[model samples]
Target: VARLQERARLFLELATQRGLDTGLSRGSAVIPVIIGDSALSLRLADRLFEQGINVHAISYPAVEEHKARLRFFITTLHSPDQIRFTVDALATTLSELRQEALYITPTN
Candidate 1:
């Protein structure tokens, strides 16, 4: 479980560094990238799927509305390279979505 925690920590740090939210993930194997918009969450999941990452999209009912997110589960089997690739892919995909105007950045 220590290995899993470490992987999760790495993923959280990398994702947070890229401006993605590692929501409610306190050393847990599950890391959630909160996207806020349900449609954007689903689109991000689909985009990641196209890049061979199988993350799940959590939307309203599963979570509160406007708190939709993409959920990633980290395992000890994942290597650091894989984690880096996933984070890069996620960031790229999100940037692409933003460029396409499918994602609207939320104002604080």
Candidate 2:
């Protein structure tokens, strides 16, 4: 649990420094990164799952109404490399999704 907390703190620091809108509390091992867009959150979660990484997303009624987020569970079994992988994957996935959204959204 101590190791998990350390890894989580490092991950959260890296993520926040990179400007990701993460909402997870530093005190908890479970990390919640705000996706803002529910669909994108689900899509990212699916992508991670397909890669053999079990992740979850919160949307709408599951959280506060109309809010969406991706939740990451940091367990004692997770190594530093694994945590780094998850964080990197999340950053990459989010960047790709944002780009796709920008392209798909109709311009005024």
Give each model's whole-structure lDDT: 0.89, 0.80
| Highest-TM-score candidate | 1
Could you give candidate 2's per-residue lDDT for residues 1-108 as a string of tens digits? 678778888778877876777764777877888888788889889988877789898987787634588887777778888877777888887888788888795669
**Reference-based TM-score, model 2:** 0.85
For all candidates, what are the clash counts? 0, 0
**Stretches of model 2 off by over 4 angstroms after superposition:** 105-108
lDDT of 1 by residue, 1-108 (tens): 788888989999999899987777888888888888888889999989988999999999899967898989899999999999999999989888878874556789
Could you tell me which residue pairs clash in candidate 2? none
Scored by Cα lDDT, where does model 1 land? 0.89
Hey, what RMSD does candidate 2 come out at? 2.5
